[model samples]
Target: MPVRHRWSAAAFCAFALLALAACGTLNTVSGIFGNQINFTAPQLQRYLNNSFPREFDKLGGLVSATLTNPKLTIPPGDNRLRLDFDVGVRAVGAGEVSRGRFALASSLRYDPATRGLHLQNPEIVSMEVPGSGSLIKGGTRELLNAVLAEYAREEPVYRIDSDLLARLPSGKRIGSTDIENGLVVVHLDR
Candidate 1:
């Protein structure tokens, strides 16, 4: 083989090795410096379960009940309570990444009688970890939990038409009535 060809081959091999080395470092960089590894649903759920209920109990008047209307078309479960929730997640800024907040506003069909809908909130909760990445999987769980806990109960999160509330056998009192002096009970335990 020509000397120039040998040099060229050597240069190509060096570039290939460098490219492989760069690729190999990606997982390690993700491990050490990216938010891709921190989004664990189970872990977040456990944290929320422990942290949120106490906050709820402290914030009086929001009754945690469940849906009992046999004629109503809604998600299954005795804990399907109607409630209003506001969720916010703030990402702590680090390095070149700018910090930001994710917020969600929604009125839920919560059953103050069964408290089933509380489960729905956490299902909507999302978070951004510094290196592990955003916790899109069931981040809503914590977000819902947090929002429900902090919700101001005097006003209905969303207006339930009196007629609709009246349709449920246990309606009006649990549905249209103000949760201000009402109680909010969380049925889903971690």
Candidate 2:
């Protein structure tokens, strides 16, 4: 090949390699999964710690002191519960490549005396983008934020069924009072 032609080929290869690297995939046309911006365990834990306290306080009042108190409320005092959360993208419907989902699983503990609440679980947050390479960081960040908000506001008393309440050892019916009384928790679901 002429010198110019060789240089052109070399440039092309370099560009291709860089492109693959940026996408984090090289095995297929879809490329490696987009780079995942994850919330570190510590980071997520802190967020939950900060948020749950405020949220729980709000939710607890609604549950134990207000008209909405019939719902299961996070106990008062120093209780620590940890949970694992995963956020990822999945194909939800036809003709769509993927939609994001944020999942969380964990335990909650509270102490009425010390007034502390603890959450324990492995938390993960990720995104599911369409197979088409168009993962917009700004949009994803906003979406993640929204999810986080939703997760933070989840209340213990919002979804109780009367029949279920009757079966409870407490013998109290508390599910139907109101759906709008709890804190809002948002996060990316895996």
Candidate 3:
């Protein structure tokens, strides 16, 4: 065999082996990483605590409200997410402003069409209006519920960004979402 031909064959074999090794490395890395991503409860809680107040303030209406000092928790063995915060509300026409604290519990659901997570069926479990008489407090609670109901129908408490899911491996999509032991587990299609 000619020396030149032998050199060309050796180079070709080397290139082929390198290409195969690269493919193997890629497969190994993907396998190690798995097909799922998890957002722990504390991490989400921090994100909400920082951003939710600004988002809440965007809802301007008859009873405009701002949520402050927000705290989020997921109860053990429960699939729901709970948020507690101090809320300041102002009536549009009445010129009445009040401060209070409230807690909301919501179930988590993944919307396949949107490729996002949503807080569904939010319920105001508790509310307190400081310095208000019983009658006034009752009226305030009713009014808050009405306002919340309207908002609930229109928006979710929080939504995971679609762009986040877009970065996943091709053909990978959110398969399921569950809250377990204060963590939000998002399973992805392999």
Which candidate should be chosen as best, given TM-score against the real structure? Answer: 3
Q: Provide the clash count, candidate 3.
A: 0
- Residue-wise C-alpha lDDT for candidate 2, range 1-190, written one tens digit per residue: 8999999999999999998797763221111112211112333344344333221112322211011111122223312222332333222232222333333333432222322223333133333444435554444345445444444344331122244223433322111111111211211112
Please give, for residues 1-190, the per-residue lDDT of candidate 3 as tens digits.
Answer: 9999999999999999999999866522312136666665665665566566632332356556666787878878888888787877667676656789988887766766544456667788999889878876776677666655655555444456656656778887677767766667677776
lDDT score, candidate 3:
0.67
Better of 2 and 3 by TM-score: 3
Taking the tens digit of each residue's C-alpha lDDT, what string does model 1 give over 1-190? Answer: 8999999999999999999999876532312112112111222233334433222221242322111111111123322322222222332332222122233323234555432222333232223323334453244344335544455332223332345333433311332211111122211211
Judging by lDDT against the true structure, name the best candidate: 3
Looking at model 2, which ten-residue stretch has the lowest summed lDDT? 62-71
Better of 1 and 3 by lDDT: 3
Off by over 4 Å in 3: 1-35, 54-60, 111-116, 146-164
Q: Per-prediction count of colliding residue pairs?
A: 44, 50, 0
Task: By TM-score, rank the candidates, best first.
Answer: 3, 2, 1
lDDT of each: 0.32, 0.32, 0.67
For model 3 the local lDDT of residue 95 reads: 61
Score every model by TM-score. Answer: 0.21, 0.24, 0.63
Task: Give residue 51's error in model 3 in angstroms.
Answer: 2.3
